[model samples]
Target: MIEPMADPKLSHQLDDKTDDIKKAADVVAAHLKKLEQTQKDAKDDIGSAQWRLKESQIYNITKHFRQIMNQYNEECVAHRDRCKKAIKREFEISGIRRTDDEIEDMIENGFPGTFSFS
Candidate 1:
């Protein structure tokens, strides 16, 4: 039986790509952390409806948060795609798309995020 040849030259490129991806993921994880903290603090400040102005502001803030979260979802999809592509090119994987649940789990576990991953 014959063994397949490997491209030792590509190893450095793969390492570099992996490093870049990990750095970008770190930045994303940090942002998610801050966003989660903001939401928690806002929720903590939610008093009774007597403070009409505060309630109104909180409503607006929450709306903005929702909109931003929608964008975050899109970003997560894009990130997964990029990771899949890079992994495919670097590691020669097949059928390399990450499931939504798996990506979410990875971000929640190995990486980091604001919300409780419960």
Candidate 2:
């Protein structure tokens, strides 16, 4: 079932809105890829290490994993920000007037779900 836009004027804006959403998704994907690579590097480092579970040595072993986790979290935040910008643009182009609370809910929910505009 194809649901048509209620406003015909907004229909013409669909292509541009979709492009913005795709660009936002691509930005997120790129960050995620970086996060994955960071995790892989941490794993390889741990696998190659000769660990005897010494206190200081254990700290060294865990540091890389911690760094990777921090980087992954940062990427997650970046993805959220990108999604919010895309959603805001979508709402603006479609001329959908939303309250700040409603927009916040949509941003928090991210893409490809009930809350998404695209």
Candidate 3:
């Protein structure tokens, strides 16, 4: 036998659907918050990584500069002494000794046109 339409059963079903929707919304909200936090953490991590990379680059450049400086440091004195001796020997042979400033000035301004290796 068909019973008369009862509104209360339909109301109960609607309330249940509403409750399910609310639960689903809450779940989505939680996930969204987690996603946002994850993105923020990742951004912070990238900043930290960038700083470390820069630090490593600075360290490598300093190491290379130190290596080059050390290589030149060992020979600088010997090289200067050799140049001094050669310049002195040349002056002695020429029967002249110019002042240091004169030699430096000549080097800076170039020798006179009359000067020749021969």
- Among these predicted structures, which one has the highest TM-score? 2
Residues 1-118, candidate 1, lDDT per residue (tens digit)? 0111133344345446657866775676566667556655676455646455655655676577557667755765676566434433433344345565665465333422222234
The predicted structure with the larger TM-score, 1 or 2, is 2
**Cα deviation of 113, candidate 1, in Å:** 39
Residue range 21-110, candidate 3, lDDT tens digits = 557656755665565455456655556876567556655655665565566545544544444445545666877877777655643343
Candidate 2 residue-wise lDDT, 1-118, digit = tens: 0232334345446546656756775675566557555655665455443422333444554565557556755765675565556566677778777766776685444334323454
CA lDDT of each prediction against the hidden true structure:
0.51, 0.54, 0.51
Best by lDDT: 2
Better-scoring candidate (lDDT), 1 or 2: 2
Give the Å shift of residue 98 in candidate 2.
2.7
- Model 2 lDDT, full chain set: 0.54
Ranking by TM-score: 2, 3, 1
Better of 2 and 3 by TM-score: 2
Model 3 alpha-carbon miss at residue 76, Å: 7.8
Candidate 1 Cα outliers beyond 4 Å, as residue runs: 1-5, 44-118
